[model samples]
Target: MKALVVYESMFGNTQQIAQAVAAGLGKHVEVEVTEVGLAPDEISAELDLLVVGAPTHAFGMSRASTRADAVKQAPGGTIVSTGRGVREWLEAVHPGGVGTMVAAFDTRVRAPLPGSAAHKVAKALQRLSFPEVSDPETFWVKDSTGPLKDGELERAERWGADLGLLVNSR
Candidate 1:
C-alpha cells in the first residue's frame, strides 16, 4: 500500500521522529516521507495511509499571528517557528472524502505540558473525515531544543510498525 508521512519540525527533533516512523513503515509497506511544506498533490485516495506530525509550540499548534509577525519582521517568515504547516497541508488535501486512513504524531517539551500537537491534529483529521483515525502519538523532549531524551526514536519506530498493522488489517 502507498503511504505518506509528513511533518513540521523545529530544531529537527520532529523531523527525526518522522524519519524513524517512515523507516519503520518502509519495512512493511511502501512509504513516502516529506516535510509538510514540500508535499505535493501526489497524495490521493489510493494512498492507504497518511501520517502527519508537528512540534508543539506554546501549548497549542503554532498560530498564524506568529507566522504573520515573522513575515513582518523577517524577509521570508524565517524567524517564527511553528507547527502550522500540518494544519495548512491538511487544508490543502483534496477535500471531498479522500478515503485515506490518517494518524498524527507530535514532539513536545515534557515540562509545563500545556497540551499536545498530536491530539490537535487528530481532532482536525476527524473533522476532515479521514476514514480511520488512530490515536495521536507523542514524543518527549527534555529541553526546548531537544536530543529526545532516550528511546524516543525507538518508540516512534514501534508506533509506526503498529500503525502499519492497524491500517493493513482495516
Candidate 2:
C-alpha cells in the first residue's frame, strides 16, 4: 500500500510527529511525508491512505492571519508566510473517490479544548466522501511554541501503525 502523510508545522513539533507517523506507516506500506505546502493538489489514485496533520491554533486549524500572528508572537520559527497550510490544502484538494482511507492528527496545548485541526480536517474529508480509517487524534504540546509533551512522537507513531493496520484490513 502507498500512504501519504502531509503536515503543516510552525515550530517544528508537528513536523516531527508527522515524520514519526510516516515512520510507523512505513512498517506496513510505502509512505511519503511532506509539508502541506508541498503536497500535491490532488490525492493520487494509487494511494491507499492519506494522513494529514497540523498545529492547532486558536483551538482549531490555523489560518493565514493566525499564522501571521503566530510569527509576530514567536519572532523566529519556520513559519511559512507564502505557503498554503493544511486547512487551505484540504479545502482545495479534490480526492478521486471514497476509496482512499483518511486519518487526521494535530498538535495542540493539552487543554480541555473543544476544537482541533484534526477534527476539522476529518469533517472536510467526510464531506468529500472519503472513508475515515481512524478518529481524529491529538498530540499534546506544552504551549504555543512547544517541544511536544514528552512521548507524543511515540504515541503518534503508534497511531500511524494502527492506521496502517486499519487500511490493510480493507
Candidate 3:
C-alpha cells in the first residue's frame, strides 16, 4: 500500500503535524510527505491514499492575500511554506482516479472558528471525485503563527493510523 501526504505550512506547525501523520501511516504502508509547493500536480494511480493538509487562514484555506499577510507576520523570521498553499495547488491538481481513498486535515487556532481548511479541502477532493475515506480533521494551534497545541501532533498521528487501517480494510 502507498500514501502521499501533501501539506502547506506557514510557521512549520502544519509541516510537523504532516510528518507525524505520515509516521503513523508509514507503519502500514509506504508514505511520502511533501510540502504543497513541492507536491506533484498529478496524483499517481499507484497510490492507495492521498492526504491533503494546510494551515487555516481567515478561518479557511489560505489565499494569496492570506499568505502574504502571513509573511508580514514573520518580519525577519523564517516561513516554512512561502509559495502556493493548498487552495492554489488544489485548483490545478489532477487526481489519477476516483479509486484512491482520500482524507483532509488542517491546523487552526484552538479558538472557535467559523471555517476550516480541512473542510475546504474535503469539499474540493469530492469535486475531483476522490473517494472519501474519512471526515476531515483539525489540529489546533495556540495562535496564528503558532507552535501547535500540545498533543495535536500526537492526535494527528493517531488519526493517520486510523485512516491507514480504514483504507486497508476496504
Candidate 4:
C-alpha cells in the first residue's frame, strides 16, 4: 500500500512527530512525507492512507495570527516562515477523491484542552467523506517552542506502525 504523511510545524516539534510516524509507516508500506507547503494539491488515487499532522495553536489549528505569534516567540528569528500551513492547505485542497484511510495527529501542551489541530483536520477530512481509520491522536510538547515530551517520537512511530497494521487488515 502507499501512504502520504503531511505536516505543518512552527517550532519543528510537529515535524519531528510527522517524521517519526512516517518512519513507522514506512516499515509496512511505501510512504512519502512532506511539509504542507510542499504537499500535492490533490491526493493521488493510488494512495491507501493519508496522515496529516500539525502543531496545536490556541486549542486548534494555527491561523495566520497564531503562526505570526509563534514566529515572534521563537528566539533569534530561528524559525523560517513557511507561507502556507496545514490549515490553509486543508482549506484549499479538494478532498473529493481522497482515500478513506485517513488519520490525524497534533503536537500540543500536555494540558487537557477542548480542541486540537488533529481533531480539526480529521473533521475536515470527514466532511469530504473520508473515513477515518482511527481517532485523532495528540503528541505532547513541553512548551510552545518545544522539545517534545520524552518518548513521544517513539510513541509516534509505534502509532504509525499500528495504523499500518490496521490498514493492512482492511
Best by TM-score: 3
lDDT of 1 by residue, 1-170 (tens): 87889888766788899999988888777999888778764567678898988888666565566445434544353442354477677777663346788899998888855788888888887887786547888998877667697999999998888888787777
Better of 3 and 4 by lDDT: 3
Listed per model in order, the count of residue pairs whose N, CA or C atoms clash below 3 Å is: 0, 0, 0, 0
Report the C-alpha displacement of residue 109, candidate 3, in angstroms. Answer: 0.5
Residue-level error in angstroms, candidate 1, position 141 = 1.0
Model 3 RMSD to the real structure?
1.1
Which pairs, if any, clash in model 4? none
Pairs that collide, model 3: none
- Which one wins on lDDT? 3
lDDT tens readout by residue for model 4, 1-170: 98899999888899899999999998898889998989887777788899999988888898999988987898865653377988888877766365558999999997766778998999988886778999999999998789899999999999999999988889
Output the worst ten-in-a-row residue range by lDDT, candidate 3: 74-83
lDDT of 1: 0.77
Tens digits of per-residue lDDT for model 3, 43-152: 88999999999988897899989888888897485688988889989999998765888999999987755989999999999999998999999998998888788989
- Can you write out model 2's per-residue Cα lDDT over 65-104, one digit (the tens) per residue? 8988877766554564248898898889998755998999
Q: After superposition, how far is residue 35 of candidate 1 from its true place, in Å?
A: 0.3
TM-score of 3: 0.96
Model 2, 5: alpha-carbon shift in Å?
0.2
Which parts of model 2 have CA positions greater than 4 angstroms off? 75-77, 80-82
